[model samples]
Target: MTAESALTPTPAANAAGLPLALDAVGGDHGAVPNVDGAVQAARAGVRVMLVGDRVKLHAELSKYPGAAGLPLEVVDAPDVIGMDEHASDVRGRKDASINVAARLVKDGQAAALISMGHSGATMAASLLILGRLPGIDRPAILTHIPAKTGTVALLDAGANADVKATYLAQWARLASTYLKVVEARENPTVGLLSIGEEDHKGNAVTLEAHALLRQQAGINFYGNVEGGDLFKGTTDIVVTDGFTGNIVLKLAEGEARVLFGWIREALGSSARSKLGGLLVRGGLRTVAEKMDPGTYGASILLGVRGLSYIGHGSADARAVKNALLRAARAHQSRLIERLSTELSGPS
Candidate 1:
């Protein structure tokens, strides 16, 4: 595929006149959130192809008023890979909902795909169907982590549990391209996740990776950053092995939830505080918007051939809709093409 083919054509329609393909049967709530999400995106002027069972999809689509009037299409792919199913074991099930949507994107029948299914399955399907980018061996899971200033790119979120120092180096290069093409950030700074600010704090791998990043040339390496630096906006991109990255991702998510819960409890402790809470509701909402991970949508699987996004398995309608929008944006911005080209060239 050519560089331009990775992006979704935005004028009138795509070359195949297709929209995003959503695995409408993937979420935990069955087809409700998926259908609602598709309706929401369509109402927002994005064309969508909800991929799932024919009869069930139409039934869900009919629940929303004016849904039929929007640019919505349905393609049936009835099989579903359960959340507990191992990705490798289920790879041959080409008829699975996730696999079907991936096939659509791979065959040029759709611009991009969004799935709130077994995340590993989604990643596996993307690799199995769409294949990897020319120079990338393993695809990294990249997501927009809400930061104190703006949002920082967190990569290798949960794709490969173990990666080489060379992989981390390549991740920095890909992240730089991602920041430029999709995020519009020029010359984004990168930081390696380590125990301390010192260059020699991490293990042998990180120590080696730090040296590699410093000499990587194209990307802006800002040396080592501690865990506290993630939300501090210390750097534009944070790179780490999938094991560490996944732990950090979950820790941040849980921390945010607990923090909000505590605040809510403290606010309702008394009438005086309740009034105070009411007064600060607007301010709190602004804070919530900044902290909510749903605002960032699905983790973009970089190094994959076509654009594939994986949403939370328990995603609600809002989260699903945001994932769809994120996928569309990545496609329109040609994130995959840029990463492929960047990695294909010299460091």
Candidate 2:
């Protein structure tokens, strides 16, 4: 099929305002948080299709009064893919919750798929079933990092560990399109993550990618940005291979938790500190909320033919709710279609 035609959603999939398909049994604590999150999203006016063992899912739904009244439907998926299972296991378990959820999107029964399950399995199912967007060599995970100014878009968060310079350049274009269409950013700037801010600072891969990005049209290519620049909001988008990007993402998450814990402990150590803490409690809470990974929830699997979001395995109800809402918003915004046009257009 032509690249454009391949990227186009089936008519059923394109039907206005379809519900988001959620893997109800895929997470550290399966079913409970997923059901609660689905209920929360339904209350917020987003339709949800919960895919899991129907009996277990219904039992969980019973915990919330009037949950039956919400815009929620359960799709029976008898199998489950454990967090420890290899992603390739999806091939053997076609009835797995993640696979079933992905099928909903492929069949046009849902607009998107959201899973707080096995990350590898989620990515595998998305790529195998929905296929890649035209001109996309490999799909990358787009993650949002809270920055001093605003959120910074980081791609290849954990998709392809070893990548070529060309892949990095393509990700820059993808990240740019995503920020503009989904984030409403105008002419978003791109940054190549490297050892230093200089053009010749990085290793062979980054050095080559920097050259490609400088000449690439459409995106506002910012020069090299160091690791520290991520929090400084040095650029609207940061491009890196999955290995480095994944490390950056995990390190940021760990540091944020440790720092916040230290702050709370110090604030509660004495009456004098407690008094000061009380005074700044509201402000601290506002900052804490902004830093919460749950605030943005899942990472977007960009360059796929359809929308698929992979949430943290330990995601709580709040994270799940946010993920569902975000996926719905992206689909409503026609993100995939817009990305296809941008990728297929003049370079």
Among these predicted structures, which one has the highest lDDT? Answer: 2
Local lDDT at 286 for model 2: 83
Per-residue lDDT of model 2, residues 1-347, tens digit only? 32112222332332337888999999999999999988988877788899999999999999999988888899999999999989999888999999998999999889999999999999999999999988789999999898997789998899999999998888898889988887678999999999998898999999999999998877999899999999999999999999999999999999988998999999999999999999999999988877788888799999898999999999999889888878877887789899999998987
**Per-candidate clashes, comma-separated:** 0, 0
Pull out the clashing pairs in model 1: none
TM-score (C-alpha, index-matched) for candidate 1? 0.93
- Model 1: ten consecutive residues of lowest lDDT: 1-10
TM-scores of all models? 0.93, 0.94
**What ranges in model 1 sit over 4 Å off?**
1-17
Candidate 1 lDDT tens digits, 227-346: 989999899999999999999999988998899999999999999999999999999998877677666657788878888888888888877777776677677777777777677687
Q: Which stretches of candidate 2 lie over 4 Å from their true place?
A: 1-16
CA shift of 229, model 2, Å: 0.9
